[model samples]
Target: MPNRYLGRRIGKYRVTRLLGTGACSWVYEAVDQDLEIPVALKILRPEFAGQEQAETRFRREAATAARLRHPNIVYVRDVGQVDGTAFVAMELHPLTLGRRLALVGSLPETECVRLGIGIAAALAVAHASRVIHRDIKPDNILLSQSGDAVVADFGLARALPSGSFPSDTNTVEGTPHYFSPEQARGRELDHRSDLYSLGATLYRAATGRLPFEGDDWYTIARAHVETPPSSPRAHAPALTPQFEALLLRLLAKDPADRVPSAVALVDALAALPSAPAHAATLPRLGSRTVEAFRPQVPGRFHRLLTAAVFGLVAVLAGWMAWGRTSSGSSAAPSPRPTSIDSTGNPTARGGAASGSGIPLASSGPPRDSTRDTTRHRPIPAPVRRVRLDLSAPDSAQLYVDNRLVAVGRWRGEVPFAPRLTVRAVVPDAPATCHTALHDTVLTRVTPGQRLVIDLPVRGCAVVRYRVEPRDARVSFLSLDGGNTLETRADSAVSFSLPTGRYLMRISAPRCITFSDTIVVRTSGNASPLPRKLFCS
Candidate 1:
């Protein structure tokens, strides 16, 4: 038909069927010929060929994930390139959370909470290693047949550096629906970003929708930065308040305000009680009595059928006894079991039930296709107001157009002013005053806004310095003795002060001698600003 990829062999595995496809890759169920085990193979698309950066990132993700060994995390078995296609082999699971959600509308509270705990535990491990899984959504979480959860997709993860690095430039590389506020604004990100994404994923899994839904990326990005998400209980009222609070903390606009770590998140989830109800009971698939399509059996076949019936009866007896002991003798009875036959009709307690009326068992996994189309109403606008204040140091007199406006320390909350210029000078330091003379200038201030300006003494200068270095061995000293700066190679440093005469010193190993002194005046603009030194 359409170039079917079934029945192909790659490496030591034979591909059986295509599991799914995404923007850049495809996954298939493949069998290992030697071990006789099933594995899921993820292959990169041809479009990514010749892209070195993409290839490097993919390899890094695989390598990092391979190092993680946690019960709630998916296991990565092998990674290799076969015929120019990069592939990752992993444990093959029955269904994903996405498929389950789609088939069953939304999961029960107990199941959602249990799944959240498992995911949070896995994220704790990833975050401990300084790895952030930028993408956390329903499609990336798989559910086992026994009701266990495992997180997948480390393809978009990256390790954070102490300071800044070239890798940080790609900060906005995640899906918009789950990106954090900092990520939405294209700013540096930390592990808190992943927590925010996890919160969004949990919100969707529990409510069957996204917290901040939009028609396009721009709207969603704006929502992430400026709008508060709806409370989780709004959609799922049965959710515990503590659980809701945890989700809100995860969705905090500022990274500093989010839960400090993934481990803490696990603790929070662990503290919550189990869900109130059991999972929806699915109809057994073998109970249906179907019409025999083959002819009557001979004497030997009859004997075989009798043996099969006895074996089935023995197995049922054991199963019932175990259930009675575990659930108490008076446990609620299960709904009469039913099953779908080849003719599409369900068979159970009576005649064949109407095919259209019977509910299908929620056997498939969750899906992410639900779209919210509601429009928001506009908000009323507000009024405006503005103010400004200016000041200068001793030996400095303010001047405007060859006339003195005020002497030292001139300050006031004045009305709207645009382009107010002042210059200062002193007889002792003529060269210093030459530059400081034009240092004081005020720009326009809008109504309802506040502006403050500080001017330095005419014959003296004060400089603000920050020592941002690649190595932490350097130390910064100011002649005034009030301010000091010290930092390691990977630390950010800052210094601030008034215009004045002072000495400065910097120290490091195997580097040029660093010491300087200068008399700075308040007359000119600050030049040759402190530089960020990168030491090898």
Candidate 2:
């Protein structure tokens, strides 16, 4: 598809060029006519405009960012839906932490800690607001020209009530390599979950490699839950023992074993001496007493702000030169794959299918899964456990082998069996919309694999037709291979079928056959007036 919004105006912003794309929206560099400043405008794709779930997510991201005002969080200037096109305008940055890592393999220990403190402070404020940024990765952290890191892309963020953390077991939601153990297990998450992911991101920044790697998502997710990460000093031998111990504690499998909160994380990272430390004084791994003997860590925010520009002068200068060569690329580096499901196929942006026959599109290709021959070794267990993921309507009930198992948005482990019967039921559904319950037989069981099952609930729509002849016969055929419906011996006929596009055909004994394509919608928007067909 050619770029339609390029060189055109959406509201007051004139889109100059495409910046990057995500699962459901496109980021474009647009000049705001009112403010006369260049901003990054994220707009929903045309195919997903009318979808309730997609539109809600697009708006939620804007609403979530608008609530937080911090130096390290991306600033949202405006949000609007003009002519059914929803978009958000945000401050534009020139570089991202991901792009920087790609250019320079890894940063020095001191520089890495400086950037970590800034991001931890941002997370501290966000967690105080009771908002959890479910997806925190290198791609989501943007860097300004002055080397300041700003967290962006909150499409996966959920605003929970105070002291409430819900278990999102339906699917694993973050980048595979950076998942926290609790997140990988689909357990209840709190601020500590974000802390673990930050540790993983910094692990990559310090060592130039992921803490865990595998050929597939399940392999990596299992690694996060079961395996312990190698010491950071193993990969980058130059790293100080103190820094390595901090990284290991952050990657603790149990959230309780990790840093208590973002505030504590900021303090801990700030207390690290700028140079290498002796092994005798290093904090022992998994020891909660490490904070007791540590020196009083001064407020890091002021020091980072005042000294970062000078400490990173060489980095900022190199970034400026790279920006000039790359034609001024925007900071948004194709938002992380929040919609990646267990099947390895990316779903719609909002964690559910949009109900459109057209496959929901994503802006970037799925991340490549590499085989980790060095660290991955098969573990033998007596019983085989496999995770089951089902996509059904809200309140729908799922059964396995005639026993009730779970309800909406459920992911749980079941013992491996060669063949098992699966069934789904939607209670209180209208008689016209209830789909028959059938036993779905699943085969080819494997250990440590995730299975995704989609149960479609068909709904009915009525179409009234009127032919010129009083007794003309009319028929409707579903293009999607549904059963054909017809009515005869009446001028006015009403046909009820599943909601979708259909081919309408009308015929009489003495008139030319008439054929046209019609649509059956699931809402009140379906036309009430009878369709008038002229047969000359």
If scored against the real structure, what TM-score would every candidate get?
A: 0.50, 0.52
Candidate 1 backbone clash number: 34
State the lDDT of candidate 1 residue by residue for 1-536, as single tens digits: 10123334567876555677877777887778889998888877667866898688778867877886776788888899876768888888858888888887677667777787678777777765567888888888888767778888888887766443223754578889988888888887777888898888888887777889988999999999999999888998878787788888888998888987665565456545553222111111000101021133236774596468557767997999999898864765444455545443444545444332334344565321232112222333443433435476565555442234465655444434455554543323322223334345656646656656666443434344544444534444546543454545345443333355455565565555456775444453355446454355
Indicate the TM-score of model 1. Answer: 0.50
| Model 2: pairs clashing at backbone N, Cα or C within 3 Å | 22-363
Could you tell me the lDDT of residue 86 within candidate 2? 88
Estimate the TM-score for candidate 2: 0.52
Candidate 2, 11-68: lDDT as tens digits = 8997655666778898887789998999989899988999999999888998988887
For candidate 1, the 10 contiguous residues with the lowest summed lDDT are 282-291
Backbone clashes in each candidate structure, one number apiece? 34, 1
Please report how far candidate 2 places residue 86 from its true position, in Å. Answer: 1.2
Off by over 4 Å in 1: 1-4, 162-170, 275-536
Cα-based lDDT for every prediction: 0.64, 0.73
